[model samples]
Target: MTDGTDARPVQTRRNLGIDLLRGLSILFVILNHLGLRIPLKKTALADVLPPWFLSRLNYNGYEAVFVFFVISGFLIAGNALQRWGGLERIDLRAFYARRFARIVPCLLVLVAVLAVLHLMAVPDYTISRPGQSLPGAIWAVIGLHLNWYEGRTGYLPGNWDVLWSLSIEEVFYIGFPLICLLTRRRWLLVPLLVILALSMPWTHAALRGNEIWQEKAYLPGMSAIALGVLGALLAARSRTLPARTTALLGWLGTIGLMATTIDGAVMWHLLRDGYMLLLALSALCLLLACEQRQRRGDWHAWRGLDWLRSWGRLSYEIYLTHMFVVFAMVRLFKLAGGDLRLGFLWYLLALPLCWLLGAAVERWLSTPCERWLRAALLRAPAAADPRQPASVAAD
Candidate 1:
């Protein structure tokens, strides 16, 4: 739905497949974080728990974030192409306004809260280094430099550490629109993005020894996003494939994705090096299936995945605030003499709490502020200018 302020014609019809994938990604991210923060090994049930399941949980967060990056590239690039009719006619101002509206509101609120908690000397929010002040942390986050900061120094606390992904994403986006506008030849853009996407694996291979570099490099994340752009471009051009073929691709992609995500032992250097790219390819395959379904008007097929769609709608908020829930639950467990059983209970409760907080932020704050600010920033198109079409101008 158009939020009236950004002047861009927003796609109102929700894609159930995209939502389902996004929802699944966010769930994977939460589970990964839980595995890290909670001492589940200390619990009585640890011995009985399947080792495979535990390994799967810990290994998938990076892949999930990879999915998210790809999806962002697909959706953002697709929208800009659709609105402007082509990259040659893209309106950078409108793009920035929409991005600002969608991203800034919730992000600023989260940063403010984190800063306050750090200032209050909360253990969970405490600075990781002696010289690094709260203001510096806040500045890095706002400036989208958290990834660089963490790579140079160590990590920030739980909530702040998550900003590394956000920083990488925003920085990539800062260049996305300009790059699109600069390239007059549309075909060249796809090939260029593909080249970058392919280069990502080599980049990762080059950084093999550095833990921080491997964990939070912009190149790796950007590579995923580039693959996403390639996916969108191909999907836009291709006709719907046979349902059986699409289904096979989807299943193969999903299985490969799951297998690769958990295989951190590096049984083979080639497979390990290519896994990130494979994960993006898997996501792309699924996205292609989703696109085909949309092309065929198969909305009824989404009946079972409604919860995924709901989670997808609130995915951003859940991602930003879930760390708070994790930190709180961890602190409470410590206060109560560190009962490991509480980890299970907290995990159960935290899921719903995250949904509630995210929904509240989206409804009461982010949505309204975006609507108002976008409206203020973007002006309606002038009817006299045929060259500057209504679709290209904001509101």
Candidate 2:
């Protein structure tokens, strides 16, 4: 039932729930970005939306990014654990190559295109800061080091705001595999969970007052990832839980998410601690629910949602690239003397445009580049096998 390593080709078909969640999250992210432009006026649409919705929307789009991280943890860690016996069977070289192939090509292309736009003195779009140089920005985006620096200040350099989440993903890419490699003992999972629980308070306390904490606390965000990894471990080791229990957990998880949203809105600073715990618990519950559905053979099937799942598959691209497109759109609108006012109609128009641009990048540029890189990397090792000394002779 896994996507990556199952002997059978993993179903490329989309799961309805996952896709819907992904699309919803991406939409929220866009709204959040747009909201940043409009002030919180009493008469505005921002004032009409529930405080919970506003809380969930932005402030660096943490909610969406958090959902993404949990899903990645569930899927990636689950795959790693399923193939655990093949611990030695892992192709570290290929694993890294695949990771690079998946991420780098689309990113480099976007960076190059953006750089060209910057140089051409494109009207209405400004890329450089008064004191910051283009080479530094280029280096930051490419190296993924920008998150640490840019996150410290509340300022994002132009259209590159989305790079922060990509930085977290890159960190996970390095850390999660190593965790699987090192925590081979079955008993280690317990200690890992314990350590994750213990680390949260420290993370919250250390980063609480600092604005950068919003970004730097990505390490604390690993708690949810650990929750997902724990779910995978359970799935790998145990049969289905009681159906009633699964249903309860699923409902509880949904409720937890709602409660977290409400609490975040009404008592944000007061309930911050409890809200963080709830977010982690909610994500864990979701993982449990998905596992239960898989066991029951109740696969999600719906055409519209399947399309969302396809977008989820390309979410990394959408997440990383969408901000640039959005900023560009805003600049264009501004130059055309369009109002910066927020409204249902403006958001409605913007949503489809963002999705369309994301789809275009995924199809025309990202997907093909990823495919070529993967094919080249996978083929290169096989093609060069003759160059290796015989294992028997070396031994």
Candidate 3:
């Protein structure tokens, strides 16, 4: 996407592989939450299923989110770099507008819905703290400090807890563009980002005993995004490599990503902090491979992943709203005598329902509001510049 900028690079179509990764990420999050509600130790499926299979299904949600951070960093940083050529020419107002449009509309809807649900006494929606009110929860989330608040006070109920990631991401973004803008040389960003990338594991090692470090620490997430930035930089320069070499790196990355999810390994225990860093690097490799394929005009070769493209397109909405599906399913399970075995079946039903809900939110609210807001913002006298073009789509 461009903002009528002369520096804008030639826009490419969305890569199916990125879409598929995003789709899988959201699906993993939903399934992970669903598995949490189900008492796996008491279920027949748990008994019959291989341990490896259960571990993969139940515990990989965080990994999927790691995928999202890298992907988001790659895309967002790539977009900014393309638009301004360097951060010096960047339009901070337009950049903020783009993000606000993409994120705020759906978030407002989510907050409103949850507030209503909390007031109605929906299970798992009630305020957890003695003195806290619904507006207290709402303001904390709106301020994007909910992660810190939760780390101190306790968790918000159910899906509201998902806002923690959003809080961390937005906080990171607050400094990302500024850092890029302030650096006098493009190469300087490497050292800056590298330090940020390493900060997570360092923090983890130093603060292993701290609950906030264990729970809502923001540096790890920033590290993942920074790694994506590094990946994007490498991808931009890798167009000269033979396709075969790039493809091999891509496959290796894919394998490494899958290997990180395995539960029974000594490697998992020994490399706990570095494990996520590896996942981010693998994601970067996959992204670089996709960039190579895009350059080769074969990025869309995988038609089987088209379904995932739809999921990826709506990933933001799905991520925010899927908890509603989770809460409802949990309530239904309770009404049905709380049978843990039935959770698998309920999870199946939730998948489509969450997709449908996300689709509707995108079609009716988020997409339109984003388009209108961007258009309006660009049209405003203060926002307009004849020297620059209109804003273009990012992905």
Most TM-score-accurate candidate: 3
State, as a TM-score between 0 and 1, how close model 2 is to the true structure: 0.81
Stretches of candidate 2 off by over 4 Å are 1-14, 39-60, 83-89, 121-131, 152-154, 267-270, 300-310, 332-342, 380-395
Model 3: CA > 4 A from native: 5-12, 39-44, 380-395
lDDT by residue (tens digit), candidate 1, 1-395 = 34333345544455677778888888888878877877455455467886666657655787799888888877777666556656556678877877786688878988888888888998878896865778878888999988877766777888898888888888888888788878878787778898889987798888877787687888999998888777767776778888887788778777766666666455235576787787788888887777677667765754677766677777887898888887777777678787776566777787777778878876788667666666666753322221121111111
lDDT of 2: 0.59
Ranking by TM-score: 3, 1, 2
Computed on alpha carbons, the lDDT of every model, listed in order, comes to 0.74, 0.59, 0.74
Error of 2 at 312 (Å): 2.5
**Deviation (Å) of 240 in candidate 3:** 3.7
Q: Where does candidate 3 have its weakest 10-residue lDDT segment? A: 385-394
Which stretch of 10 consecutive residues in model 1 shows the poorest summed lDDT?
386-395
Model 3 lDDT tens row, 98-186:
78767887889889989998889877888868656788789889998887777767777877888888887888877777877788567
For all predicted structures, in order, the TM-scores are 0.89, 0.81, 0.91
